[model samples]
Target: MLLVEDEDSLREILREFFENRGYEVIAVRSGEEALEVISNKKFQIGLFDLKLPGMDGIELARRARENDPDMLVLIMTGYPSEESVKKAAESGVYDYIVKPFRLEELEKIIEQVTKEWRMSRENRRLRKKLADLEGEIW
Candidate 1:
């Protein structure tokens, strides 16, 4: 997973929290750093803060999806607005999480998103297999 948050303490805390749970977390302080890091690696999920110092979360989400279309992105914000929500939706964020969220809640959301992504991938694979069989029969 890729965790992006600007605040030093929060970043460290989240990194520890996820790592303790056996998640391989690559935490970064800014979207620019995330982009650089992601350029070399891929993550199954991304936890991004919306109000980043440079290249906000929405843009990062977009680029992340471009790198890994099946990646699940969750946006976190201390300050939420209609525009940001709309932008996040447009960026294909999997979910929006408010600041001061419970760790358990975030964990649940992560599980749900990953489960859905896996199901969708499986469905796509099945569809492709059926198509191939139909072509062979025809």
Candidate 2:
């Protein structure tokens, strides 16, 4: 998982929270840094702040998805606007979370995303296995 938040305290809290829950989280302070990390590693999920110093979350999500289409991205914003929400959806974000949110709420969202991600992964694996078996039979 990749977590991008500009606020130092919030970033630390979120990183610790996810880490304690057994997520291998790479936390960064900017979209630029997140992009750099994404270039080197593939993440199953990404949590990005909508506002950042450079390359806002929607753009970051778009670029990240270009690298890994299967990645699920959730955007967090203190200032939620209809325009931002529309843009986030257009970028294929899995969800948009408003700030001042409860940690439990975030956890529930993560759990749901994880379930879907696992199901999708399993489906792909099964398809590959079936294809290989068919090739063998032929």
Candidate 3:
């Protein structure tokens, strides 16, 4: 998992929280740092704070998708606006999580997102296989 948050306190808290749960998290303070990591590593899920210093979470999510189309993006925001919602939708984020959220709720959402990621991966694999078979048949 790739976690991007500007606030140092929340970043450390979330990093420890997710790490304790057995996730090998690459936590960063800014979207620029996140982009650097995303270029090298492929993450199944990306949890980004909507408000970042340089490149906001929405733009980060969009760029992350360009790098890893299969990555599942979840945005964390303290303040949600219609503009943010529209941007999230445009960015192809899996969901937006409100800050001050219960850890339990986040755990559940992570579980669901992981499941969705696996299913999407499997579907892509199956589609490729079917296409290959069709090519051979023709």
Candidate 4:
């Protein structure tokens, strides 16, 4: 898991919280750091605060998707403008939570996305097996 927030306090809190929940978190301060980590590592899920210092969360998500299109990404923001929310929503972000978000709710979103990822991975494997079997049959 990757957590990106410009606020040090918030980033630490989220990192600790997710860690306590058994997630290996790579928490960072800016979207620049987030992008670097995303490009280098394969995290199951990424949580980004919308207004980072160097790059906004939306753009970070875009770049992350470019690196790994199946990665699950969640966006959080204290300042949720209509345009930003709409834009992020359109980009297939996993979920959005406003600041002061409840830990329980965040857990639920994580669980939901994890479940979906598992199913998608299983489906992909099955499809590949089917294709390979068909090729062998011919």
Off by over 4 Å in 4: none
Off by over 4 Å in 3: none
lDDT for each candidate structure: 0.93, 0.96, 0.94, 0.88
TM-score of 4: 0.94
TM-score of each: 0.94, 0.94, 0.96, 0.94
In TM-score terms, which candidate is top? 3
How many pairs of residues collide in each model? 0, 0, 0, 0
Q: TM-score: which is higher, 1 or 3?
A: 3
Cα error of candidate 1 at position 59, Å: 0.9
Per-model root-mean-square deviation over C-alphas: 1.1, 1.3, 0.9, 1.1
Colliding residue pairs in candidate 3: none
Between 2 and 3, whose TM-score is larger? 3
Question: In model 4, what lDDT does residue 116 have?
Answer: 91
| Model 1, residue 13: C-alpha shift (Å) | 0.9
Write the number of the candidate with greater lDDT, choosing between 1 and 4: 1
Q: Write the per-residue lDDT of candidate 1 for residues 85-131, one digit (tens) a residue.
A: 99999999989999999999998898888789889889989999999
Q: Can you write out model 2's per-residue Cα lDDT over 22-127, one digit (the tens) per residue?
A: 9999999999999899999999999999999989999999999999998999999999999999999999999999999999899999999999999999999999
